[model samples]
Target: MTGLAPNVQLFPIESILDLVTDGVLAIDQRGYVLYANATAHQLLGRKELVGKNCGLPAAHGVGGTDLQLVRRGDMIWAQMRSLPIQWLEQAAYVITLTDITERKRAEENLRITAGVFDNSREAILITDSNNIIVDANPAFSHITGYSRLEVLGRNPSLLNSGRQDKQFYAEMWKTLNHQGAWRGEIWNRRKSGEVYAELLSISAIRDDSGNAQRYVAIFSDISYLKEHEAKLRHVAHYDALTGIPNRVLLADRIKQAIAHASRDRHKIAVCYLDLDGFKPINDSMGHETGDQVLIEVARRIEHSLRGGDTVARLGGDEFVVLLRLEKDHECLASLDRLLALISQPITLKGSSYKVGASIGVSIYPRDNGDADTLLRHADQAMYIAKQSGKNCFYIYDPLADLRIRSQNELFKSIRQALEHNQFEMHYQPKVHLRSKQLLGVEALIRWRHPTRGLLSPLEFLRPIENTELDILIGNWVIMTTLAQFDSWRRNGLEIEISINISAYHLESPGFAHNLRQQMALYDIPLGGLQIEVLETAALADIATVKNIIEQCRRFGVRFALDDFGTGYSSLSYLSRLPVDVLKIDQSFVKNMLEQQADKTIVQGIIALARAFDRQIVAEGVETEQQGEALLSMGCEIGQGYGIAKPMKAEQLQTWHQPAIEKTR
Candidate 1:
């Protein structure tokens, strides 16, 4: 009933063919030409096949059967299909020519896409809108141990192990439909019925009508990833070796604990514990053993702590204990009990170790609410505990810094000393008792602190050592000593200023350059400045010492061995060293008169000095008998409380008066 006649037709047939972009050809009952469309000739490559007879083989009108045609070096596909059509009151042949070039290209693309999906290391599956598996690649088959035929038409739930709840699935569906995609972890079962963890990603594909027609899922076995992630988590939040809460987790705990205490208006005790003599153990027993001991110690300390209290190792042999004892003095008792347990000796591997903990106690929300500051104060208190001997704890005394309160106030006072010239240098005059003349004025540092009055190095230097204020105080010492030498030269005094260099100064890489620069800054001669270094640290690093001493000596600056016999080195080191003068440590000088061995040692040193022809200055001589003893033994010089107790710089010029007049 399909009409193609010129008249009496209800509807036209071209309208139906127009719906298809493919080419259509019709033939008459005798196989004679009836009609042909433009695309059909183009598809056949003849371009003039209208009214052609259909008796020829179907391949003749087209390029060829199964033959590749090249246009611009591109393969084009031609397909022929014949159908029966009614036209002119008889059955006619309707041959359809479809230019499947694009379809073939698309097929090739789909094949490549399929190849990739099959070869992928990650499992890939495609499903219909209902989540029933329509296709699965080789990777999915390999991962789930299921063949393509076995999984196809089966829902993805076939692989579910029921590990995820219905709510999780609902959330996944909601997320996918709302966001067009979802990705997460899930537990799935293999064909062998074994369960495994997998990371999964699902995507919904919609048609032009905007309704989801298909879904794509990608997954991977995440068992190895889970193991690795767990390892990193431990390393991130807990110490790897000790398996205790690390600094990050401990700080977090402290912060959370402090916040809770603050809400309750309660006080929290934070104790910082540092193992005493732990360094010696680390050095002697090796780091492996040290780590074991720390783990054991962490366990013991945690065990000893009261329930609900947390003990976190802050790396090394340092630990922090958080006690949220808001009522009654429970924290103190708990801390004491834990500290006692920690003090017990630990036996590790084959060695028995005894290490005491020095604990610094700080109360949070009371002393301070901030976690970092509280930990710092606890650290300071720990040092105080160390000062009171080991195996003990100390509460942070706010008045600790007050002991040097006046000295701190003396910064301005010291500044005034610098400005109004209230500052002066004292000299403990070194006497050449053999030659019996003033040799040198060792510049002793004295701060005419206003509120604190005149303070010696002993009274203020310890504080300087424990703080950065040492640099300021050190600068004053250097500037004032150099100025004194300038004064002595102005008065025609030839004596050198013997200034001591702290290890902090000497080990400073810029020390030699800075000293030379300072000499140039003040226009003072380097020859008149004698830098005295204590023997202990001066010899500790021989290479560094050699480099520094050699570099400074090049500027015509000289060095004297101060506190000579105090170091642990043998005498063989002295004759070969770069030092210019040997000042016998006062400890050796004090016993020289009474101890025959001290006399022999001094005599040996003097004899050795005479052989090397080095200047020998005997220190700490209060008695003339000591001086005479040194002088008779061929010792040449002396400086100590014997002459004057480290006098001010102003006293040095007149100091030579008494000794010079005594000889004259």
Candidate 2:
């Protein structure tokens, strides 16, 4: 164990082997373990191995061969080297054993890592310092539709889509060189002659001196994801029904239009349009036909304007047009063409339907209104055009809309009165003309204005007609009438009461259902409640009114066409409307005795009602002579001051008692 001379014979073999760190083995030409050292016994897990044969092959010139050994039930690796040495001064072989379990484990891990690199799903590419692709994984070939042999030694530029410019590549390299990595979206071409988008990441493999030796790129195709994103973006900004810019995109477009107008010193005209007489078609033909009509309308409006102009549907049959104009006169021509185009006839389901647009224009910079205000002003103008006999366009006039806007206070007061129960229903008696018999009463709405005393519908109702206010006030009238009827029924006043329903309420989809709910809430008899709709309301959408009438009839409710002959009522259209009664307009009745033309009109209406087998009620009858004339003309029912003026619910009982007694 001390020291040995250069000659192996000068040292004890066992001592020399014990002093060495490696396992020393002596074997004959047949490879038997004749001499085993302490380290070899410990590594091989065997002690009595003096005659055991170690069958390990020869090592290649200083490079050791690997030998497997079992130690304490665990498999381990050892480096074995066979050397020709003097063993017991006879011909023999010496084997050196070195434990290399940790090194073998490192090599196994490297093999597994290489396998993962070749089999990953993401395309993998490796490039040398000269930017030549030295290796490509199977995934790279699958993604690019090329073989690894086809792409090896070629530059990655072969897959370039030519979408990235020289500057883009320069910036990419700059960032990659500085940060040691680069990741972003890129466009690349496939071997199948298709271009696609990909999310790519490149990492620099550096040498010990910090110089890049190779680059590893990993990428995934993201074309489908990008396509899905584009689809979502389109849906967000476009109307699914019409495939045009919706309200969301329209606002953004208007903002851009305004900015452009301001910079170029040009004016933009915002025109708000509404289709006249479209409701009846939609109500009659169903929503499918309605959708077809709307599509055609959109197409016509879009084609009617110049290329730069935009027409967007604001829902329903309403559309907004943006016209770029250099002068005020330009608006006239554009509006004229649009109106003409929209008024053209559209044929659907083998029937020709004609609808006209009422257009209201507000010029930017000239009107001094922003996008929202301009839209509102144009809407106001559109209402004027409709009131002025539609199928026309009108420029906005602030002075004209002043009175309309000024009614905002009165509107607020009406709403407050409704909320506070400051409104009342007045009952006007409709009586049998020949016998003075008590018939049903018409319920009229009256506002007890606190400051202005009692106000008739004529004073404030006209301002809110055809608006949501009308719908609100109409609902109030209905609920109040039902409650009043319930109270009257409790007191033995069993007369049917009819409440006038506005066009807005009559055309509402839930009108019949709402009425049934209210009737149920009040516990009133079904036939005890009657709905009086204006002749104009019925004309607005005949099919809708017919459906509402049919639905109400199912619940034992009756319908009466009020103020008949005041609208464009024809026998053909009237034949489609199902109602129980037709009330002659007061204008024709109030002066029928004084004016012969009024008398002829009333006679004709009475005759028409008789022909149609409809009960005729004369309104505004103020004299016994007028009642007698109506009776003579075959009109039996009369309502007005002559029959009985509209009286409070409390007065109704007392006023009806005398009429009942007189009828006896």
Candidate 3:
């Protein structure tokens, strides 16, 4: 009955072995399988594995060797261990198998992660909870110029460039504690003691309880980017030619200067300079020479100027100098130095050239001008300096510039009118005051403006006095007068013509020769043409005017001293020159009858003319009373609105016929 009990104790052993998921087997010392549990058969994928030798692997290696089980076209890794145990009352070995495929895979992933951490381009550093460096990757050593052996056990603060203060680190730690991470740009030093920029990101590794166990920092070197940014900044603010501040930078400096001046209650002078003769050299010698000259000039200016002053090139041959001064006169010394430097001989390519500068200074707040307006005023002043004389400096004068601008417009208009033949000669009749007979006509220039009808010489002539435009217009009047004289002579009107001549034109070296040539060309006799020269003009150089008059007399060309009574040397130079006519200035003639002083001056002028044996013609006689007064003073010839206001040539001819009949 007990033998037939179905081996109840063996069932308990089989049930205990089958309860485990891991494979369990009993093997004999000969390596033959004695007993196998269901888990073993299922894990091995073979039901016939038990009660067979199976040539199973033995646990004979140094550490319990691993065995491979083939199951349903898949291989399962197992860790096998054997130990001696009593199995079925026989000497046997207990074998245990544990599937370890997933554990192996997990270990492989950890190895890959470690490799990636070491091989990354970015540097990786690990620090303990106390902020001391614990480990560093190869890339960390390469980037920070420090080896792992050198960095381990040291604080990461060793790599600090000292660019960040304690406050910065404190803020960084505060951010790290609040956010568990911190990322930003930082400056660090390399092992070679060279500083570098880095983009660093740090993360705190926390344990399960959310407490930081270690700190991991990843950093990338960004020194190249920093250098590039510096280059961009330089290019933006510096001038290419002079290597100094450009307009963009100068604006910033000017702002600072204004602030400083405002605080100190001092004056700031803006000096605008233009080289006097740089253009001619640049055009003639080549741009290379010009560049060299500019370089030298910039160097000299920058060095000679006081510190804290800024000199900037506005481009081309223009430069702007900012000077802070305690007084207005303080600018003078700087200006003197600038002028001296510019005057120094510039030597280039074995050739020496002299250059000068014209500077214009505009004072701040005093002129009430802003930065741009100050520059504008300085430029205006510079032009004035150029006009007065080059190699000098000028202060901005608003009133003077206003007058200059107004006159400049007149000068330009006069030039344009001359070019367009907009000027005409109006002949005013000069008559014998007693007989009322027409003697001759004086030629007066009138501008026939296209827009504004006729304009008298008084309206435009004074602005161009003593300028090249005066000479040009004077020549024009002469040429046109001679041609009119020829036309009148052809028409049987034998009238002598008196033309006004400027002092500049009269004093020219070859005036006599040019007059002679023109008379011959026009086929006109010298007796019919007379030049009316101002007394002041003629006496400017008494010897020269006397010689010129004598030279003209040889050709029978007459000279008259126009505006005789207005000059101081009228009486003194009267005897020295052989002039035929004395045209009294209209100023005295027009007012002689009004004021007794004027009457005395007119009488004295007429007496002097007679004593000198020179014919006198009174001008600007507008009324019969003035003409009668001049006649009473022994002046016979007079021209005025009282005698047919400056008629055209044809109108003069028509009036002459009737006047001749009346005289007869």
Candidate 4:
């Protein structure tokens, strides 16, 4: 049997395919079926399959049925393989039969499955191990607003927004391959042309060998969240009050601008603008007006800047503008335009208040190397402008540094001026026109510096006015004047004393109260105390000014419209005021004889005062001619060197008695 000789061996083998569900039959030559199994006998009936043809009718039910016989016109197809072969030393044909009905049914099922795959609602894509797409689902077209024809061979990047960088995609791929799935927020685009944010999950599919063959990504629209987040960021960065980016955003943006300028070898300008005279409007008129003015200020700032610039609110009357300039000259031009825009008058309630702003501009890459340094430099420059009498702008320079030190010393000296009793006031008399009687003495402030002997209101008042030190000096002027008047009252000289009021001093909420309190404390009758308001102050927030005047009026404290006819507003408005005197400006009186216009203005003021039934006094009668001209113009009350020089409290009687004797 080892390596057996084929001639000597008598080997037999049963049919190896007989166990299959198909019928097996053996046919010899002459097409006679010689061997047939149970399946074949049952399939080709006629009692046997020994003489069946290959295309035989299936005969069953133990009769000439379609399963077992090739009956007349009965047709059936069967699996049959045939060849001429020797079974027992005979030339014969051997054929086999197989029942293939189950296989056909299975093929039909596969066709149905293929139909479902093609019509699926969810996007279905089939790809090879090389990621070459072979099939796609219907939902792909519906969701992407594109037809399958357009996306058949394309990758998923057809929806890419480029919002994510390469590393973002690289990481995504790494995670998806390492794990089985990865989900994330992604920015993508639609075929019809819009970008959208999507929640996307990509899954890796592998073969039985565990090698990744394809990727499946499912995504949905998250565009709404993107829009909502944008809105939230805007709300966070911009000011609700003014609609400009707030200080927080301004700082960050300026830092960014500075960085860009540094990189590009360029320069930027930073301007710090704080509205002057804004607090008075808010404190006296109410914050409602203040907010309106702030909004208006924002509008003006936006209108003033170049298109390449940015303006932001650093909260409360403080605004900062950034100008990315191509050249230093452009920055200068921008600053000039900004100043002109801010200088225009803003009107409210039929009353116009024109306030100038102090703008401190710092040019960068030159002034400083960083944002914080530049902002500080600009802020320091603004302080210089305010110190130099305000309503101006200053560039921060080395010279400005010296001026800053000088201003510091000046402020320190002024602080001492108040702490010590270096501040004093003297009074000038007002005469009654008809009786030529001493009506009142207008209080004028002076400073007796410890070393500077004496300084007029012009010299030291600027410093006091620039600071809130006006409040302190204002109190001194009021208290000391009343105390001196009470001393005169003790001396049995019954004369009214009028004290000048700064708009800043009067607008203080405690001003009227303090005045009445001091009057009570000094035992000085309010009638013997008239308050003088400059024409400049008379024009500030007339309603509030009127209220202060009225409040003092209730205390029997009279008011005088100091320097009448010099203001820009109508004198008729002053008629509504409860003032008791009108002092002709010295300039008008000085040129009254030389200028016919001055005569007409003086006469008109005299007539206006007569109509208002108020006492009129003319200041600066330095010569007999000036005094005679005023007297001729029906301005009997005149106070100047001609009447009496401003004298000390003790010298008042000596100075006034001579004038009294001359008039009598």
Off by over 4 Å in 4: 1-408, 432-437, 659-664
Q: Which candidate, 2 or 3, has the higher TM-score?
A: 3
In candidate 3, what residue range of length 10 has the lowest lDDT sum? 1-10
lDDT of each: 0.76, 0.85, 0.84, 0.74
Q: Scored by Cα lDDT, where does model 1 land?
A: 0.76
lDDT of 2 by residue, 1-664 (tens): 1222125454465776776778777777666766777787787777655666756553333667887888889999998877776766667776788999989999999988788888788999999998899999898888899899998899999999999999999999999999999999999999988999999999999999999999999999899999999899889887777887777787777788899999999999989999998999899989898889889999888777788888888899999999899987888988888888888899987889889999999888878767788888999889889999999988997665677568888888988998899998898998889998877899998989899999999998988877889889998888888888888888887788898988778887698898888888887776777788787653466777788889999988888888888877655546887887888989999898889999999999888888888888899999999989988888998888877889998998898888788877
Between candidates 2 and 4, the one scoring higher on TM-score is: 2
TM-score of 4: 0.44
Q: Model 4: per-residue lDDT, tens digit, 558-660? A: 8888888888874755667778889889888888889999989999999898888998889877777877777777888877766666767877888778767
Residues 1-664 of candidate 1 have per-residue lDDT tens digits of 1223345344466666645656677776565656665555455555445455534233244343333444445667756666666766767667776677777889999999878987999999999988889999888988899999998999988888988899999999999999999999999999899888899999999999889999999999987888899888888999777777888888888899888887888778889999987899899889988887788888988777667677888878899988887674786687688777777888876678888899999887657648888888899899899899888988886566455566676454555566776555667777777655877778777667657788777765654552345555556667778877777788888876688776566666577887787777665775778888776753446677778988989997888878776677736457556777888888888997789888788887777677776778888988878888887888868887776677766666676677778887
lDDT for each residue of candidate 3 in 181-267, tens digit (9 for 90 to 100)? 999999999999999999999999999999999999999999999999988988888778878778888878887888888888988
* TM-score of each model, paired residue for residue: 0.52, 0.54, 0.62, 0.44
Considering summed lDDT, which 10 consecutive residues are worst modelled in model 1?
1-10
Q: Order of all candidates by lDDT, from best down to worst?
A: 2, 3, 1, 4
In model 1, the runs with Cα more than 4 Å from the true position are: 1-41, 44-64, 80-98, 132-135, 141-172, 184-197, 264-267, 284-289, 348-351, 398-664
TM-score of 3: 0.62
Candidate 1, residue 152: CA error in Å? 5.8
Please count the clashing residue pairs in each candidate, in the order shown. 5, 0, 0, 17
| Candidates sorted on TM-score, descending | 3, 2, 1, 4
